[model samples]
Target: MVGYSALMERAEEATYAGFERLKRDLIEPSLSRHEGRLIKTTGDGALAEFASPLAAVRCAVEIQDGLISGRHGFKMRIGINLGDVIVGTDGELFGDGINIAVRLEGLADQGGILISEKVLNEVEGKLDVGFEDRGEQQLKNIARPVRAYAVRSGADSPLTERIGVAPALPDKLSIAVLPFQNMSGDPEQEYFADGMVEEITTALSRFKWLFVIARNSSFTFKGKAIDIKDVGRRLGVRYVLEGSVRKASGKVRIAGQLIDAVTDAHVWADTFERDLSDIFLLQDEITTAVVGAILPKMLRAQIVTATRRRPENLTAYDLQLRAMYQYSLATRKGLAEAIRLANRALELDPRFGFVAALASLFHMVKVILGFATDPQFDRKEAIRFLRWASSVDDGDPQTLATTAMVSAFMVGDYESSIEMIDRAVALNPNSHWVWLDRGWVYHTAGVPEEAIRSFELAMRMSPLDPMLDRLCVGMGMALIELSRFDEAIAAGKKALRHNPSFSATYWCLASAFAHLGRGAEAREAAARLLELDPAFTISAWIARGGQSNAQLAIEGLRKAGLPE
Candidate 1:
């Protein structure tokens, strides 16, 4: 009951119904088979009494193991206690044992089980599941302190279930630099001013430790005034950088604000009016000033991120900037042309960090989505380009990240891929692609929170990027993993707005709708997905990027009519 609010706040009635079915089929049977009496079940934790403490622990372990076999984040905690009880007249039970059970349940990790010392002594070595001693725990309102131990359900290790990620904790400082609005009196000058912001954003992105929001996703809110907190909530960022450029008389007036999006407070604000010739220097000054101002104010823990990496050279970055213009236009021909330009740049300078990495990325896409007649060729090209680029400046952040991304999908070296992405991101703080690829890496690694951060950052990097449909779909999957179905649905709809033809959005919509018990909408979305990609199936879901994410995505679509 302690976390019932959070569960109900996140999960839908249908999700609880699924859990109820699970309880009826597996949990109730296993409990009865072991002679355990059902007390009551809350949203995420359950209570039951057993004639023997050993039976209680055994039933708890079995229930956990069974629930985890399925996907969809419908998980719970279990607590077992052995002590005297007082039964109430209204078919309810009460006692110190009941309180102890509730207390121990509160202490159990998600998808984990905990037992009092009394229950532990009886259950020792009786069950096949593993156990870890969390040591004695003291709780208020209970007469005496209690001793508790954690029980692992076999699939998840005791260490993984309990240990938290250091980088993504709430204490970590993060910022999103939104696309600077174009307020030049001349409409034709929009691109010029935006180009300036993009360059500034690109330059700023080279810092690995600072959490720079993706330009494409952040610029999605451009041209419209907005609430800062809403931006924070949607993007899950702590700080926001907003500015507008007004160009006139061969000069530009640029105003920027570093707002604490969470509190809607302006931490820093400055406006620079300069001649067009001073554009490059102005951009550099802005990047340095913002970075300098923010660094000292950052929390001490963030000062030492897990990794440090960066690319030493910027020569190839020029090619990337030009290619980005064509990519942003995003016509099939335009993207293809952009790839050609990037490839030529790679040919001229094989070790050009960003160009070679992106050239490999283009081929990697050709392999994944079947843009190339020979996927094997595309994959081989990706590996070759990455290998050559890695040899040139292995210390380059973009190089490591691009190599990692290709390796994760093509080579299946998940750990090395992530380690490389970490190194690359450390080197180039403003590399949106690195962050996006890193998110994909986490999704593949089955770490949902980190995945969400990566996608969110991706959105910030390319606010107008035509490719955001996939990023949004991926972000939705991450939310679903964390059991935020409503938010997941919201993200899916955002994806649909950008690219109506995106098959993944249809899948996300189908999953979110089904998980929420919106049967009609779910069916419609699933139908649309089948229409777009007839080969789409649970198998297809698994073959894509994330296994655990795909499993739940399959559950959602399968329930909506697409077969397993």
Candidate 2:
């Protein structure tokens, strides 16, 4: 009832029917099975009081199984109130535990289940399911925030998603910074200590020639057992930052050690403890000590050991060197950091076309990822950067090509994205991303064949990556849009084979079935799509990130009976 928007997206008619059927068949029987009571059901969501939080969870798991096995397109999200819920004027309850349950439900996946920490502690060792601690979430309108965790949907837990699993570093310097221990006894204020290490790892990522292991990779060590030299060898980084935070009622204490992996030497070490309020300033000192101290030295050593004696014809590749560095960071954090550094670099030299071009590269992804709250504003920023780069340096092919791609793909001037990619390809035959971006543009334009060829070129240049997977998803959906069902299914299967966990592949599969008139398979594929992403409506998709390029897939799915 509370999550109608989510239910209706899966199925407008079946969602309702499934609700009634579940009430009559599974729910009423479950209450009898567990000696429980039926609290109430509004429309799409349900709220209930349980005799035991233990019974409440068992009922929830069974409810999910019934809906999925029954082929009901609608998925229900469950929340349970273990304590009192005082009736309100509007006929809703207002109490601490009940209020917490409502928020806990919102955190759950649309058709998946989420439970409060209170429920978790009560049901601990009694249930067979696993949990992923979501941490102490700051929510709206709660006096004491609850600690939340996500329950695995079934006996099996979902694999935590990480990008591009670090292949054998083969001399790659990938590393993670474990959360420094807050030996400070007061667990309530460890945010300051934890946040400092994350920023330093982020700064290390800026070294483009280096492969800084991702933040998520490093944070897995927030508070656990680890050997320093072993961690460095495992993470493939030559150095590690291990530290502890200690605080007393009157003072603070901090200590850290950076060890060289191969030599096992303490290359850099420092300790600083100050009043809690000065923690932010103290962090900068730690960062400067680690970054300004050790990373550059490691990079210099790696450079000495690298196969290539020096940059190949550095005189001719100056723009390539600088532009490539800018392109490495396409995420929001990376983009913002890139913009800051790019701006500072520009200030040092007003005619820094290369930096401006890099700014455009970073901003374009920023626009794609919904990084800025105002889409048009960031789009303007992207355009401004590209335009400035183009105006100043007509000879820089990197600037010209990036300018063109941003123009066509993001701004809806398809001609320009294609033109720039073409020009860039002419200038530097080895730029793999240029080809990939071109393929992305054509795929957006609903030109499947051209997109496929460009993607093929990109894949040829960088064969190890799963870029083919994206191409397959885009082209397969395009094929379905063109009413080529068999080909679409074939390509979709290929995509899944490469990355079975990818959700987009299911979207591609559903498109093929919808176009082929296999309503049963189409419905199943749609269910799979929902399983992958419950909030996957076209409108939300566009809002989350500009999917102006996937309009054809959206149209096909909408026509193929995707619920509004």
Candidate 3:
């Protein structure tokens, strides 16, 4: 009966049929099971009579839960009241309870259940569900005001349910950084405050272990005071960060506070004051401080949660966490264990696209690190797993970016790879993975400048990213292609400091040093590369495929005494 007027007038014929089918197949069965009898049916809703108020409320809950959780194509608002009523001989019920229920239903949100005080008093402590007291409301034609209570069904309540998708809270720590208020009383500094939040959000997202909502979604609440619990529920996040920035008399001050939104408990608060000598550097310093402060807190929180989870009840996400931890070890034994964990995760839930993509990336890593017994076979498996991941959820930027880069590197399908990665970037412009992966794709597609830009963007987005070595290596490769030998060598040296075992970084150093005519350094780097992968050769590089700009790298490698 709620919003039924527009439903009847605006809905198509099939919509009406679907509604009818919902009532026939779902509502009627639920009512029958609850021992409620349908007295009459209206175009949009129905009237029913139960033997007791408890039965009536339970039946209402069942019907509403069914319609809301099931694929009924529509949702309904339900109301129940417990009161004496007149039963006509024809079986139609006539009473103030019926009228009040109808009126309460109209007041309820779609897919909600509202009951009067009498019904709540009767059902209290009997059912597993709780009620949200909505306070007393004056009803039309009713002698007295009725106290209304909305049923609170855990996990299935209207407040929690989204359309066709359940809320996916982060398996690890999740946080949202709301836009910083500009308290300077100057409108021009608004961008500074907004940039501060964006930087923090971007920095946090790079943790890989933390789930940070994108700036676009978090900024929606800008300039609005909100309840932390409401924010947690709305965003499916457990923590929230809010702050303000003020700039006056050439001094910049930024203050931020992180809160456990669930319990409304303050986790941390800090303020930084510095002369605005260089605005960008000041922002960078603030970003580093915030990221540094939050990471340890989030890690402690994660450790506490992990300690609490029973081993037997480990979820696929838990397996993923284990897998990523092993992957981060970046050794042969670690890679093997990572693969094992990923396989176990797949066994538990094969439909998880993120896990599938992760497994695919593991294989890709095997190919790159020379860990596979048969590189071609591993390449094929990587492609197959990436395809599987895409089939599950192509919209996920992580999946798309990883899959796309794997396609480019393993299959040499740079055009299709770039297309997929572009889509990922479009889906989430703030995702560092998209930028990083697209850098590789663009480099292989013969666009060194574009590749460089993408890599720089990745660095900006995640200054402390665990994958910063990869970004440095990628930028070095692109710089080498541009014949910037010294710059490439510097980048390669930086990359080596982070991940000395990475063969690509050594290869970059060798090539750049050779091109710069530094024979001793070039030979030393080439020797290190051969130590890591003695079978590495120019022939394999040619077989792997590259763009026109790749000739510079090939020539430099040849000069560095690499095998052809």
Candidate 4:
């Protein structure tokens, strides 16, 4: 977590509302844009977590830069560190990770970020910031020695011109592709090597999450035996790709290496041997392999750096993480456990809108799947929680999207639901949840084509998303409404592969298979659905705002031998 504290004591003494405006109006949006989760906030400062050290530092820089140039009247000091943490049953954080960061915050100069050595090592050359290495010092109550570094924002770095005056690193994982060495000795083969570099760069740029440096800037290092650390500093990239291409005796060989320029760590290295026939084909093959290899390595590194290993002392964030795991199980037991964990998280921080929304989702799922003991209570509580979430943080796209779905499905307020969901989409078109919820809204509105398009778009945004099964189930339902039974069957099967226990997946399969008159398969799916959700009933579902094209699913389930 990054701890940021305002420098002005008068700012804290001002009206509480005025201080909150600075956080709500200025600081928080920057955090959201960088995928940081705000854990808590006092009148003068806040604590937040990012997926990686790079994101934490970047967000810190953005906050400081905004304070200097924007209307915000005060500067802030930020401290960041990486370490193991414990998750409490109630939502709160504890461990050296939290303690060290807060102490370091007090040590930072106004408008600058101070990072522990652990953070510096993970993000040194990856960012354009200069580091003033502060030697190891003993922190209060900390048993071990800790080294800290002052992260010089681009404003303080001499290389700021090469890095541009952006003042912050790119939000996504950024990379630079140096010119591939022409090792074949034939001057004519230089074109092939250059073509490989160009092709690899172009292919990698297709992923929206990747920021690829332009070919012109990358090619500047082509012939020189340059230090990649310097290259990373110059380009403001986290990873650098360098390779060599060789051709002889009708055979082509390509070797590529991906480096974490900050720590100078070799992340991934590979070599490929292929036939020289059809030069373009060989180039395409090598390009695909190199890009494929680098992406996974990058993802693994980011995930590992972003999240610390869970410890025995659980914080609110850790509790939420645990709840999400239970929720993914989508079983009766899992739903109960998920609800318990979510409620505990809310108890710890009643103002935590994200957790309130998640708990509401658990209740809504119970109501929809006929698992709730008090269906009416669950329905009303879900809407109440969602409304509270909206009141707390209306700018949160996920909360808005979830609120929209609850409004439509539980409150039967379609007009307000559509309005809220549209607002969410406008706020964040890149959010997969926003698209998925929009798909559901469209499905309930009987717009099958629009629903399919929204689902497909969600899949495109997050091809390997953990919630892929849910997306597939939604798409299968939409396909069934379109009378595309074959496609629906395929989608349902794919959903099952991802999450066999997801009741919706079985229901979708049963409906699709029954529509296709595959009686045996339909019966099998129906049995599986009943096993997971014994209380499920087509008539009950229809009674609870499951009208419109959903009748298609109800009719199919009836044919598959489910009770009316």
Candidate 5:
């Protein structure tokens, strides 16, 4: 009940009489009608429970409507939450569930009812009343912020007005970073929280593969309680990042979670605690950590989604995702499937430069693995696709990086490949793909030390990347070039652990072991390599032209008794 004390001061006797009459005539009857049990009552307000959230909300609306229509001198405020409650010995309700409802009632508008997100989720579509998002509330005695919604009873409601048709999602991965909640209990720290979001948004925008919602568009939901699916629809994004920031004593903590907006599934989450010494540096560190962590997760999620879709329903982007997944398998059959998918994607969207670059990479891989039946045909196709990709979208960092690899391995244009990869790094240095491609380009150009450094940096950037096998293989080949045979063998073993089926791992191990005079191990590795790729030969590998920069590896392969 609202204004109870004020009404009592105006007319204590009449107020007390009216309260009793109203409780008997309206509140208790409405509660019974809706299957609600009145647990207990404070002087002005009451606590109640219901078996169904829908019944509880309907009862709240009925009571509020009765108060308004019957001209009750005072109005009541209500809050509803749905969760397990601790039943006391004396039949009193207790728990965070009850506490949250109490806090929500206190925060509710004078005559309005507020409901927790859990309750709203249960009662939203079933109820006639519309809900106005009250945003995330820092409830008293609550450890985490609770998202609340205000129930509005009328035909013309914000829910009806705001929830229109959703826009279609973009072809590439899309994301929106909602403003972080300030749990610092100080208004001044709001700027720090906002700054953290801005830094993350800026860093994520660097990845050309991601379509990030503009700050202005994302900021529109800053202080409103958001439905992840609704926000995803409105923003046309796949992922949403939301979090809270807390500053206490001499340190600050930033907690973040990545959600698949469409499914409302949590993909990734982490908390970073840092000293309050340098605000800007802290923002940068947090941003780097967040962006690096979520990129691989988003990719994995996308791949899974693409894999589940029917072949007939695949779009150009879906084909690209499938192709990438195939490429990650690192096998001759996987390479062939990747090329087929890439070509299909090109037919769907001829101007998809990323797919064009991917096609070039597939062909280059075929040549490298000696899988190409016609070496010259594969070489020509690789060059053609690279040229088309560069002409179509030279600005895309991923496309540029992939084309750079083809330029070095297929065309033997070391200078141009180096320049292209340098440009790609300048464009998106945070991208592990760019760094990985840069490593391969440098290795093919015979800069073994620089290749190792680039590969190591890539490993640091995406420590959990599924494609770590490729990085280790590059590092192993570079180690062999430096005559660090033992280190090369170790790198090969690690690569094998990441992907035992990868034929290149055996090639790396065979070369390293043979160079170290470990003939038995070398022969064993050579046998595994032949089992994986029966057509593999020293002549075909050299004829591919990329091995000019890897002469030591070629010599070691011959020493291991591989077919010449």
Candidate 6:
């Protein structure tokens, strides 16, 4: 029934007569053969009911084959669902069952049959045809998402071959954003919808932590009814984003939703309506909002997935995730465990630049937190691992960012560290970690204002990040340098809330309190710092390099009566 309107527009008398003959000769007889009760008929299509789901599906396939083989000028799209139906006195069907099937037909491709999950389950092995899982779809007017399947005519279809094998997902978060449907009805508005998708894809690509499918790969499914699970398999992604764009009456509406392709779970969804005054500005605004909203959700999803994985089945990437979680705790025991996991990951993948850089950063943390059993050995190993990570993959933004922080703090090479961090940010501007590294590098290079700006940008990008304490501590350091002692104290306390064992937060709090002439509070802060790091001393901290840029903090430590 797909092209009925077109046929009517061009039909002659002979064409109309032939169509009548087709219905009388082929369609009616097939319904009778399958024991289908014809309920009603419209100009373009008919509604029929059968006692068996299997009979209904077989009848659909037979009619489709007959239409194609008999050289009929048009094709039909069919949808089947199995559910309770309410029949009216006029023999009309009224209920969700009928509504869902109708919506599925609208979503179906020309000449194809779509079936609900219930129908699929009942007729799967009994039918000769194959079923392709279309994943969970939000049918028009449906209260909940429904899983649908596309029916293939033969056993030799590609879907049958792919039943047991699909591409493995990448270690990091991955997504594919399909081209949005143009709901404006005006064909000319296609370009606007496509541009919106492209803008979103490009913006998401800037996040170093995410693996985004290329635009060309994603656009292949445009204008076709697709299964989200199939698209995820073909693209090797974990999530899929799809939506619609409508432009009318001097305004535009865009609706998008993210789905976990593996589980068909709705991860996030939102809608934006705006005046179409500035199209490019509108695109930018939507892209930023979409990226900012989905990132934290995706990260949380990834963490949950990784946590559920068995320890023995851990991949190099899974080990890296575990290491990251441990590092977020910011305690001596946590750093030790994180280092161990990073080393295990390195053993599995010798050239893993991210984990190698993490190992180097963990060693540097030991010296900074006064947790190193042998400071000299830890410093040497930190530099050695940093060199190895750069040699393996200097272009990786995370590696470069971590290397820059180590260079600034441990080696006191401010100029080179700043250059490296700037390049990392330029490479992946959306990466919060890169911005966080920029904050620390600028702070140690004697630019407190720029450091504050960088830290603030990082916080804005990933507000729910587990490592948010790092950002808070960086901001506190910059505030102290600017003589904003009260703000520094507040920032330090916030950092403590995030990770109370972090020695840097105590250092910041103790210095800020002393600068504000709160002698008792400063002494209490210093006592807590001593408890965390029994070996901490004014002389030891100054000797760790980068102390020249922290003269104010060092003076405050002296005023607080810490051992020199």
Cα error, candidate 2, residue 195 (Å) = 55
lDDT of each: 0.66, 0.61, 0.77, 0.76, 0.86, 0.83
Q: Rank by lDDT, descending?
A: 5, 6, 3, 4, 1, 2
Residue 382 error, candidate 4, Å: 1.4
Which structure among the candidates has the greatest TM-score?
A: 5
Model 4, residue 192: distance off in Å is: 22
| Tens-digit lDDT string for candidate 3 (306-360) | 5467878777778777777677667777878888878888898786677888888
lDDT of 6 by residue, 446-483 (tens): 99999999998888777777777889988998999999
Residue 445 error, candidate 6, Å: 0.9
Worst 10-residue lDDT window for candidate 3 reads: 158-167
RMSD of each: 23.8, 26.3, 14.1, 13.4, 20.7, 19.4
Tell me the number of clashing residue pairs for each predicted model: 24, 5, 0, 12, 1, 1
> Could you tell which candidate, 3 or 4, scores higher by TM-score?
3
Q: Which structure is stronger by lDDT: 1 or 6?
A: 6
TM-score of each: 0.44, 0.37, 0.61, 0.55, 0.68, 0.66
Best by lDDT: 5
lDDT of 1: 0.66
| Clash tally for model 3 | 0
- 271-387, model 5: which lDDT tens digit per residue? 989998987888877787778778999999999999999998999989999999999997778999999999999998887788999999999888888788898899999999999
Name the runs in model 2 displaced over 4 angstroms.
1-355, 369-372, 466-474, 477-481, 485-510, 517-536, 540-551, 559-564
Question: What digit string (tens of lDDT, one per residue) describes model 1 on residues 145-255?
Answer: 888888764353432222221213122356667777778767887876666666655554444223444454466687777999888766667777778888888777878
Please give, for residues 326-379, the per-residue lDDT of candidate 4 as tens digits: 776777788898888878878876766777888878888888777788888888
